[model samples]
Target: MIRIETPLTDETVERLRAGDRVLISGVIYTARDAAHKRMVEALQRGEPPPFDLKGQIIYYVGPTPPKPGQVIGSAGPTTAIRMDKYVEPLLKLGLKGMIGKGYRSPQVKELLVKYKAVYFAAVGGVAVLLAKAIKSSEVIAYEDLGTEAIRRLIVEDFPVIVANDIYGGDIFEEGRRRFARIDL
Candidate 1:
């Protein structure tokens, strides 16, 4: 069980190659479609974002409300394709990684290769299980957006699959074909 800490150290990112199963710990920020748009706009306007991107990993999710004594509610990965447009520029700004589910576009794939970034896939659904990993959470930006707001969450043993990696390797495609039943 590989464990990754936030502000992903080079050693950590490098260790996270394609096809690795990892349990991520430390702080991760949540930003879905709406929040991503606002973040990009803020960057375009030359305004400093509420959080730093360097060595950071953004988790794509809009989690449910937590019960008392819980750091966060059911947290899970959302589809990542929607955020493709925003990732590259963020990558250019030193964003090293992202955590979400589903496939990404060629542009995003290219950016990953160009910037030596990685895309990790958190299991879709299984929110209750996922929430168990989050130790704490706080809204850091776009509060008016409610659950879609960006939040910084500290986690422990957060499970994920490395879907895409710096070398341009993609596990989803390969895994799909490898497991698909073919009647020839």
Candidate 2:
């Protein structure tokens, strides 16, 4: 398994290819639909984002409340296509990586190549297992959004798969083609 760190560099993103298994370490941010909207609005108003966008990774998740003595709660990836509208602007700000589930829109895929960024997929329905990787978590913005709040997370060896690569490769399409080739 390939290991990568958060705050990905262009070289690191470029080196990743669709279908590559990666374990990411270091800091990552969490945000879902509500927080994303607020962030885009802040950018439109010429206000700085609650956290710096440069080279950062944002996980599309809205985790459940922690049980006891846990850094984070059940942290699972959310559907990524829902954030398509907000992705381009974030990419323009140098956001390097994203983690979520499912395929992205064609436009978002194009922008991923254009911006030298990659999209990762964490298996869905594995929230409890995923939370174990989070070392710490703190709300950075949009607290009213509850689980949808933007959070800064320090993670160690968080697992994911490269769903879309900077070279314009997509794992979903490949999987479809492979299934089609099976003489079923």
Tens digits of per-residue lDDT for model 2, 1-184: 8999878999899889999999999999999999999999999999988988999999999999988888888999999999999998899999999999999999999999899999999999889999999999999899999999999999999999999998989999999999999996
lDDT of 2 at 66: 88
What RMSD, rounded to one decimal, does every model reach? 1.5, 0.6
Q: What is the C-alpha lDDT profile of model 1 across 1-184, one tens digit per residue?
A: 6777778866677777788899888888999999999989998999887888999999999988888888788888899999998997788878888999899998898888888788999888698999898888899999999888999998888899899987878997788887886665
> What TM-score quantifies how close candidate 2 is to the native fold?
0.99
Clashes counted in candidate 1 amount to 0
Q: Once superposed on the true structure, which residue ranges of model 2 sit more than 4 Å away at CA?
A: none
Error of 2 at 141 (Å): 0.9
lDDT (Cα) of model 1: 0.88
> After best superposition, candidate 1 residue 68: deviation in angstroms?
2.4
lDDT of 2 at 171: 96
Best by TM-score: 2
Q: For every model shown, what is its TM-score relative to the native structure?
A: 0.94, 0.99
